[model samples]
Target: MPSVRTILALIASSVTVLGGALAEPTVALPATACTTGAPMTTAGYPIPYYAQATPSTGAFENGYQPEPRWAGQHLVGTYTFGVPSPVETGFAYAQFKCQYYCLNQSEGGSFFVRADSKVGSYCECYDDLMDPETFVNNNQTLIGAWNAICKEA
Candidate 1:
């Protein structure tokens, strides 16, 4: 017969295994669009916004804070920049179908904004750090769309 110590050990091990199985499952965030090295699905899709070779990590993807216009805009996203350690600084454009539009913290980082035209043929890019990003329809079209989409909010 097993001693008390042996019985206790068996019970403890069983609890540990059962606990893990009973624990709630975790959900995964959506993948980032326009990754630097990933191959494009087709000639024009996925688009290449920016790419850097570093240990950069992004937070969990979430819905846009202020929200955006358009029905297909990404509702989940994560920012990839922060203070203390700065990354690259430059401007690039891509027509990506992002799951969420990333936001740049005020401290510093590569902040980007996107606005798609109604025709779906053109997309406007903006730099969160500055107001010098490319503009289409003199910003009216994008602003109107955003307002219209976020109106219910």
Candidate 2:
């Protein structure tokens, strides 16, 4: 028979191994600061607005305009022309805007634009899309476009 000390040692070893396996894995938090590495460009409108008057009737303009949730957030850019698939096209446009316009124009940080309701023709920008605090405060979740464009940031 095993001695009491030997049994206690084995039980302690098992608990240690089980505790490590059962413990929640540590998740790597996103960086608090990030840079897009794109040169700053001309600062345009602070928030996205209809560059042109709202069209009377169109699939893209369903009279639904997504307003900016963040105050003093710069309008990185707008994507009016969307391909057949709004999600894919929006994502691509987001990447383009982030790389060329948002990174350069807006303060160096994370941002993303996506088509929520409007057809492929309309897209809006959300600055600090990857910030955890912003998400918690605004009750906003990171969209796929953020992953496509702002993941680096």
Candidate 3:
């Protein structure tokens, strides 16, 4: 038989080993870091009819005209631009597209800004001419399209 002191020592060693085995391991997580880059801004606007078409001449009436598919409430367009850091280039491109390609009275407008070093910065504009309900339903599709565009860029 083991001596009392030897049994006590064995029990203490087993307890110590078991305690270590049952204890949770400690994990050292990385510290949270702050964003050190400059801030970005995104903006959008409605295009005016006058900017989309030439003035009416004496012989011909020249004004903004929508295609048959885009006649009433089924028009949609998206424009995207990328720059080093600032959002002005993307904003300007979106504005230009709205002025030249989108309907004069765009009912819905969406803008997104992304700041990334590998992907750089992106500004996106979505021009929606559909009815409110239709636009709402197609919102997911618009977001997916923008994501695709952003990934490609």
lDDT of 1 at 27: 92
TM-score for all models, in order of appearance:
0.20, 0.33, 0.22
Question: Residue 23's C-alpha lDDT in candidate 2?
Answer: 63
Alpha-carbon local distance difference test for all models: 0.28, 0.39, 0.34
Q: List the residue pairs that clash in candidate 3.
A: none
Candidates 1 and 3 compared by lDDT, better number = 3
Give the total clashing residue pairs for model 1: 2
State the weakest 10-residue window (summed lDDT) of model 1. 144-153
Q: In model 3, where do residues sit more than 4 Å from their true spots?
A: 1-46, 50-85, 103-128, 137-153
Q: What's the residue-level lDDT of 49 in candidate 3? A: 25
Which one wins by TM-score: 1 or 2?
A: 2
Report lDDT (Cα) of residue 3, candidate 1. 100
Better of 2 and 3 by lDDT: 2
How do the candidates rank by lDDT, highest first?
2, 3, 1
Query: In model 1, how large is the Cα lDDT of residue 39?
Result: 26
In the range 1-153, model 1's lDDT, one tens digit per residue, is 999999999999999999988968899954333222332322233323332212112211221222234222433333221211111111112223221243221111122333333222122222221112211223222111111011111
Q: Is candidate 1 or 2 superior in lDDT?
A: 2
Candidate 2 lDDT over 1-153, as tens digits, reads: 999999999999999999988968899965533423322221221222111112123323223222344424634555444434345545454444444444444443444443444443333343443432232122222232232122341
lDDT of 2 at 39: 24
